[model samples]
Target: MPVVGIIAEYNPLHNGHAHHLEHVRKLAADEGIVCVLSSNFVQRGEPALLSKWARTEMALAAGADLVLELPSAFACSSAEYFASGAVSILNSLGIIDCLSFGSEEGDIDVLKTAADILAFEDDDFREILKSELDKGLSFAVSRQNALKTVLTGKSGQNIEKAAEAIDQPNNILGIEYIKAIKRFNSNIEPVTIMRKGQGYKSLDRTSPFSSATAIRHHIRELPDLRAISNDPFLKSNMPEACLNILIKETESGRHPIFPEYYSDIILHSFRNMPAENIASLPYMEEGLENRLKRAAIESVSVDEMVSKVVTSRYPASRIKRIMFSMLTGMTAEFLDELKSNGYAQYIRVLGFNDTGRSLLSQMRKKASLPIIVKPAGYKKLDTLAKKLFEHEIRSTDAYVLGYRSPGQRIGGQEYTSSPIISVR
Candidate 1:
């Protein structure tokens, strides 16, 4: 049987996610379900509604055979790096045969064609891209123009159809996934599952199925999700109720689920760091720093800060990635080191299932690095893992304060929850 890999952040393990998993398994039924997950921070600039460990339990319970953590560096990165990191780990494991993902359109061939063109930008394409960008067109529009100029020369009708198809949000990410697979030259086959329910970033509060952003906002306001979703994992949240669940959990000396520990640090960094320094943050391109600096002084909530800095041309998502990089200290230099390694040498086991034990045993025979399922304390780890884990805990601790007065020093590797779960 082949093993398939799914790279995801089940931020809250909602119903749409459950559908994605079911569809992926059906597409690659014979393959073992391996998922590389985001730990604390997500690609979006906000904290996860649930912790990685919690998310892991949710996924394994859903259907995944095994789950591993996508190191924090890659977890909170832009779409390009997020795809790179998750794809690299699956490639390194050398076990996956098919890679499956959810897309607005399940047209894998179009995505692959787009990926092929993106992999190598020609002179014509580059010139068109530059001209459009100089004219203040968004990168998406710039890319669409470049693609059209190149493809329309030969297949005008085909190019028109492809242009309309490729411009959607999910399709863009799917292309990135294909690009990452080619970049690694991995043996994994690629497939796309069509998305069901509310559209991406849809603000339709009326739909039981909403975007993760909407659900998160709803939780903050209502906390009670059972009335909202038929999702079992979310429905189980009782007594805790909506946003108060997070609030009460933090007050009870629990981790705030995401790397919430960095709120003050992020605030301080924004407050003190110069506009020049902010520009150095990852994905901070084309004078976006001035807006960020201004927002730092004027905005209060993280959401408010992002909104203040976002421009139609620059886009909020890119700005969020930049601030997230700053919050986590994932400097470009650190990214360079990770790039050199290709796959981070550490498999900081985020969460797993019944098959995880078998997979771990299999990995030991061929793997080059240590896969630590449980991180006990600071005393035992090497420099790199220790530093990463500590910062994660610090972010967790700092985040909990919004709800409680839990004052305790988190050691180098002192995670309140078990770092890994051999979920058998």
Candidate 2:
């Protein structure tokens, strides 16, 4: 059977996600849905509202056939790196025929055109990009502005409104996904499903197809299960099965992890870290670490610390990634190694169903990298792979520190946790 792949955070599986999966299933036409999900931390540089295992169970319940992990290093990265890591894992499986994603444009051809332009980065585009960056625009804004200018016609207007799509968060990520696929020269075809509901950043529930941001806002406000079940808006936006998972996780003290939960730990990590060590962090540059180190010592809370550390050059997400890097002891050397290697060394399975088990069998036959099903197998990996896998473990251990229940803060949970399997 053919395999269709998707890359997602599934932070708390909502109606929009369920809709996407249904579309993937119909588009695949009997092919299996293989999802590469973020673990513990997400691209936004925050702990997932639910743990990876809980989120995996939610995906299986929502009709995904298989779920593999996008390792912590990549999971907590920016869009380009995050997409590259996810697409790399799916490609290494050697069986995925297509990669499907939600897009505001819902036009694969248009996304591909933009992706090719970005992937190639011709001389004219490069000059414009450098000019925008020099103006102190964030990388995302710089790229979008450059593209808008480059695609403009002789009349000084954007051609066919090509630049508008890149302004949306989903379309930006969708373009990156396509660019990553092309960068690897992978054969996986690109597919897009028009996104529904409010934008990704919108916190207001506009319809049953609410954004995850809106769902998360609801989760933060209504901590009681009875209240959550009674809230008509949330109930309509989230699937019943997914809601139960969130409730069970919250009740069990394994969920609703907020960045504030680790404020003390992060502040401590930064204050205690040696000044020289800051130079070794991924994306560290121009004495940025010095500003962060000073901020950590002066600020009393994580929120204050972030506000102090954020600058024109360093966005909030970048600051959070730096905090995570320090918390996990991730070094510049390790990031260099990853860049040189270009992909993960193993496929880490998060969950599966009966059909997924069959897909796993095919992966075993066709995969080019090691497939990790148990913690004991870490010893069999190469040196870099083992080191990278250990980083994931450390990240998870830090993730547990944010747990509301003291008992749930126990470390090494990644080693003991088993893949979430759906009963037939």
TM-score result, candidate 2: 0.95
lDDT of 2 by residue, 29-49 (tens): 666899999988988878888
Q: Model 1: residues >4 Å from true position, as ranges?
A: 27-31, 156-161, 205-208, 223-265, 368-370, 376-424
Judge candidate 2 against the unseen true structure and give its global Cα lDDT, from 0 to 1.
0.86
Task: Give each model's whole-structure lDDT.
Answer: 0.67, 0.86
Best candidate per lDDT, number? 2
Write model 1 residue lDDT over 274-330, tens digit each, in one string: 887786677767577777877878866566777787766677777777777776566
Query: Which stretch of 10 consecutive residues in model 2 shows the poorest summed lDDT?
Result: 153-162
- Models, CA RMSD each: 4.4, 1.9
How many backbone clashes can be found in candidate 2?
1
